[model samples]
Target: MLCTDCLALRDQVAIYENELDMLHEEHQTQQLTDIQQLKGVKNPRRSGTGQLGSLRADRHVFISDSGAKGTIESLVEPSDGVATVTVEFPTPDVTPTILGIKEYYCQLEESLQFEFKATSAVSLGDHKVAELAKGPKVAVTDASKVTDVGELKNLIAELQRELADLEKCGEELEVEIEERKEVYLEEIAELQVRRPCGDSQSPPAIGWTCVCSCVTLCCVEELENAQADLDTQMKEQCADYDELLSEKMALDIEIAAYRDLVELEEDRLCYL
Candidate 1:
């Protein structure tokens, strides 16, 4: 987070971190340690930020006079309610296709694009960012200044590192999700076609199918193999995401300490 991807988290990192702290503090004794010890992602003993609960995707951090709580909530509210999936093209000129899930869990009444810019406004893609960039590079960022010239420079540098990381993670996750979706879809088709005919055979159980283990597998063996792969992938993602959460927790403490340090230094400078 310190090196890469914090920039994408720009506005909402504080709210998520703060709420996590709130939940942790609420638990009092060994709850925090319990969370730390859990090797699996599905632990119900811990609080739900609901996949994200409080954590917003793609944060970009800055020092602002406005408190972190309100600032984060304002920034993420629009984007949080909607889950958007977009397919990217290798060609830079072409825009990616925005996709809808086969099963949507929510009912939303809102805009065409689910994402937003840092301003808490309805901002669009790279074109708008490019146009904004045509002005002074620091123009937008300068508005949120809560630090001296040196600190602002450091913040900008940190944000840039985060942006690169965010892009990398986003691309990786997209590729994986799409690949799994395609594999499952193909298996479904094959299984339906190859399904046993007549009253001689009984249909397979819902969870255990020839086409998809979680869905329908072309072969029962194939289902087991696919599920094994999925299990491995899930374990890997859980580990990675757990690492991220750990980092976030550590960062939450560090940032608070940094704030204290900055304030103390400010006071010492004033004394001089």
Candidate 2:
């Protein structure tokens, strides 16, 4: 087919894609609003009833019974004189969300067909803050033996070191994200320049097969260029929007990771 026809067809396709993208984005905004509400839910449990709500403090058992009835005072060791007895906390079934926050965002995105190809990069960073976080990595911090000035000083020093390191890492990530954004903007500009067409470009100045009057041809050419320019701008703007959306998702994942860390620390506490 002629370039004229091909260009027209491409323009038509661009128009359809633009409309599709707009509707998809609107729908996604609405979905995000709903998810935000769910995330902010003050309490998932009823005020009076106890039907497994998140607000209720779970059972914290202080006794264990492997061979005898579970009680606060039960022999946890064998009758043999050589073995010493140990008291264990009662275990309560704690079920975490089978899906991580990042996964939840992904699932939410997938539920919408229009945002089909939203594959964002994933990042896993190590802050080694488990000690300061009172996580499983540093159970020694939980010991009650450290009461002297020297012991307390050492623990405080360790905690301060870990906190400073974590803060430094966070600053580094912020710098990295800023650099990434600079690169992203440059790429978007390049794409705009090379994109197929834009709104500034208009239809052909002449007829499909024949050259019309100079004035008429020029007029048509002006409109065609205007349309092309507009199209390019629209596409580039959409690209930037999508990138920002992905960045937002990445941030939410970090927040969720912190929440998970909290839950993990609580697990260790229950053990203690």
Cα lDDT tens digits for candidate 2, 99-148? 24335544444443234233223343452322212112222253123334
The digit string of per-residue lDDT tens for model 1 on 1-272 reads 12222333322334434544554455433433443333223322234544533422222333334321111111122334552321111111101110111011011111112212322483434432211111112222331222244555565455455444444544554565567667777777776677676654545633235435544233444434444444443443444444344434445554664465456435433422
Best by lDDT: 2
Tell me model 1's lDDT, rounded to 2 decimals.
0.37
The CA root-mean-square deviation of candidate 1, after full C-alpha superposition on the true structure, stands at 35.3
Which candidate tops TM-score? 2
The TM-score values for the models, in the order shown, are 0.25, 0.28
Candidate 2 residue 43 C-alpha distance from true site, Å: 51
